[model samples]
Target: MPKEREWLTFYDWARTYGNYFYLSILGQPILVLNTHDVVSDLLEKRSGIYSSRPRLVMAGDLVGFDQAIALMPYSERFRQLRRLIQRELNAKALEKYWPLHEQESRELAKNLISHPTEMQSYIRHYAGSVILKVTYGYQTQPKDDPFLLLAEKVMQAFSMASQPGAWLVDLVPWLRYLPSWSPGAGFQSTAKKWSDLHMQVINGPYDWAMRNQGLPALAKPNFVSTVINQTDADLTEEEQSLLLWSSASLFGGGADTTVAALSSFFLAMALYPGVQQRGYTEIQKVVGKDRLPSVSDRKHLPYVECIMYEVLRWNPVTPLGVPHMLVEADVYEGYHIPAKTIIMPNIWAMLHEPSIFPEPHSFLPERFVGNEAAVKEVSVAFGFGRRACPGVAFAESSMFVAIATALSTVIIANARDMQGKDITREVPYKTGTISHPPAFTCSLTPRDGAELLSIRT
Candidate 1:
């Protein structure tokens, strides 16, 4: 299958092949876990053996070896990095940063009201700024700052490197031994460029903050500062690099994924105005126009909550999800999974399963609002087991505040062409590791004049 249609193509195959299916990509076993039960069995129940990441030959050899938390084996270094992430991005830590999230989300709403033409860019900036501010104690003011630009370049390179046929080195490990002047040398050189760019982005702000301790008090303490202040005497340079890599991982993972989900949310709103209206009504009833919806008001906004859940389920950011690897040889239902076999929990298949989600193709937030069981089960969008997104709390809170505030304040209308018909319906996604709606126009008029004036200030 072509990369663009990989998810839908795999879904079709999974329907025909049952839950357990395997395909060889360049002589490497690629196991797809199609059902919730199977994914849970391996990723959640047997996490100790299933959480290791499959080695990307090009990435591992060219990039810093064993210096990437996401790609590292399940060793002590991995454990330490994971522990730091869990502490920094956990529920309590997310709550601690709620004020900053709220402030940035409000700024996002104001930006939309002022420059609706830059809606997509603002979304990217908002997500990136929030993560950067929280993770590095630095806020990205100019959207095209050098650090942000380098981050984008790194993402583009990473995406290219991640493509199925991007590098033959992945398939033929022996080719990695070729000299720098070889055809595959570009991949290594690009990887080095990415590493250098990322190191500068990660360490520059940190070094500055270390020199001027307690100088500027932002809304909250950033993750980098917190990590630096933490007492980890045994942290090696390799471990520190891995920690920095994990922070970069958050920007890479959290920024694009959240923006994609929110973009999907807007698309859903345009397609189903009633769902959007219902969410608005619920929020209005609970928290009147006197104040915007805050984290404290989330529980009272069930309809909005359901909408958020549906957005994730409708089109997950990582449709294939981060592939999990087997640490030790294992067998499931009489099928032997060799050690180091690449395991992928096909979240696309699980979320779109007919038995689990009725009319899975449709945009129906009510399924979650009507059925409690579905909400509990739909958590697979984040992934399963130990390797699940550590920033779930932070991501969820950011999305909620952004979505609820946007719904409550703006009148998100579909853009019409010269013929006066919706143009967004005709837009399609450009292919990548993450799916994003192709750029389409939208109007963000404030619901009322007062709301508009408030945003102006």
Candidate 2:
């Protein structure tokens, strides 16, 4: 297995080993599923045994991520966390957040058009603002929000800590028991610092929400508020802990995913102007220039929606979905899968499968148009089975509005050189757990008929 950008290597290996292949490292068996059918067969058809998560000693147990929903093992606590989140984030419950999503996404378009050079920073701010508001009723500062910075720090640490083979403790669990001063024990000190930050992120926002819950001017009906209000006024230690960790899970999972998807969308538009033009045309036809495009206009804007799907397919946010551990030994298609085998679903490979999506690497939204199979299959990009991200509805809503709003407001085109020639596509993507389009300059010229008043929040 490669040290970094494992997804690319996994895709290459899939060509030789076919859909499903296995490897054992230091007696630890790993199963890499490279196609949708295989992932669905095991992760969905046999979800009972495929939903458990692998224990990452360095990232999970050491850095204090084990309590977060994404890395928590399959157990009662995990179920409780899922239930707490699903109650507020489900499609029906998410109706309350539409206004919040639209408000922030509109602000995003306004900020991007005003400060076109800081596209990536504005995108981060937009995502951080949305998730922070949804998870806790706290509003972000216009610039350099402390909560946003803390979340960024936590996510950066997680990306490095959770990466496969990045930390030896994950492979050799015994190393975690070593003292910080011992030789080869430097990770202990790092984990200690990250663990402190993790606690703050998990506790800081939730505490503020609680303290302000009773203040009329400060209180807003949000996930933390709603969860707290529904429960007993004086909660048990377990219940409060559950609420804190679960609510924190929302920001941890939702923010980065939103940033990655929107980043990829901008990159795609820069690379493929024709598709971007088509999307802009669809937006103008469906939603007149009198106002910005809202998430509600999604159905009317089919081409725009296709562009969103294609962006996801072209460069998935989580290229390799979080590893799931087999619950017990089982047989599948004449293969004996031992218990505890780490299941890595190569989502990038599935999205790029030639048979499922022809010209898989090409940026083509038309593939999803009038094609139910292709559309349904792409759902794997979110994840699969019991472990699939519960924020699907929320994710899609935020992404669609952001994409639609941007299309209505600006034209995303490549930057020009000193001689005025279009700078050709060179940088592709940054590889990690969540893949983002490498930084590239894009001109965000305001679209004709789109006025400053239309994007005002």
Candidate 3:
């Protein structure tokens, strides 16, 4: 009830009143689940009645994202689109994309060697390029690209719309019908402008590929052409429109979250030089510098895997797992849960459990090694139930390839000051539905004999 950061608020609430609590905000009943067991029981076990999303009038309907599967309500359409995405991004399917992952991530490492200060941009390019290539078969030159700029635009709208009580129209549905100039009804203009931007962001790459008409010669079959140009494709106009939205959602889901996770990875590397050194030693043992780290090496390199898990647990991008709406009334632990009640998982608190992670706030990949029960789970970072992130396999593989390749090639240390002393700044991260580190500086010197993974590899 007090005015504190959401993480602090959720953590405090969980610690004081146990892992579950109920409250009313803006006349809406809300349930927050913080522990792993309760979340597993309700969101995962009773998924049949907990898969729908609460109404997001401002962020989804007004900002024109309702059609995106990530925001779409649970329905036949969402199920179909999710199946399509899973087909292309599931664990087995993601193997085909490994070459692209390897290429882009190595490119990021090379770019960092020359421009260490621009590490953040390089991470964005790697993620955006991979998703765009897979979803639309479009290659992004990236510099001054309007589409890249749109990713920033998406984040701005996303951050604003996700903030509770930020827009009055969300609370009062009738305000949506108010004229653009009406008093106490400015959300109309905001929605209209964002709607146009959202459309362009989703459709731009597909439009470019269509107009180019040389899509057939591209390196691979992208989601856009593969679906719209199918011999069996006889879609109604509405079906086709939804298909377009679904294709874009692939990039929407992967790009920002990947950026956040990767940025956090860098911050982790910077703050813990000893950890980086230890990880580098493991990399050399498993993956020789003759070639970059590949997915094939994941099994042999347990420390690398531990680092990946630790990064996700240490600072998950989605602190409060995406809100879900109850489809029917249910009872849990003797408490009544009414239909339509909003459910949110306090992912931050669960991931930060002091019992599991001894020094919950500390960065220690070793906590995940040799002990499953002693360590907090990392899969929850992807969410839970039928509405869980469909891009989990694809996203995990993307971050893995990127972090593994980058770590193998670079010495990521805290940047040095003009006087030649090590400079350490307090790590600061932005809080929202999507979390990310603010701009921070780091040093990336090439490792011994660490040439770029040969282009021909």
Q: Estimated TM-score per prediction? A: 0.90, 0.95, 0.93
Pairs of residues clashing in candidate 3: none
lDDT of 2 by residue, 108-140 (tens): 887888898888889999999998888888899
Each prediction's number of clashing residue pairs: 0, 0, 0
lDDT scores for all predictions?
0.74, 0.85, 0.78
Please identify which of the two predictions, 1 or 2, would achieve the higher lDDT against the true structure: 2
Residue ranges of candidate 3 with Cα displaced over 4 Å: 1-4, 212-217, 228-235, 373-376, 415-426, 454-457
Top candidate (TM-score):
2
Better of 2 and 3 by TM-score: 2
Compute the lDDT of residue 243 as modeled in candidate 1. Answer: 60
lDDT of 3 at 404: 84
Model 1 residue runs over 4 Å out of place are 64-66, 163-166, 183-186, 217-219, 229-246, 415-428, 449-457
Question: Per-residue lDDT tens digits of candidate 3, residues 244-339?
Answer: 877878878888888889988888898888888888899888777677788767778888788888889888888887788898999987999888
Best by lDDT: 2
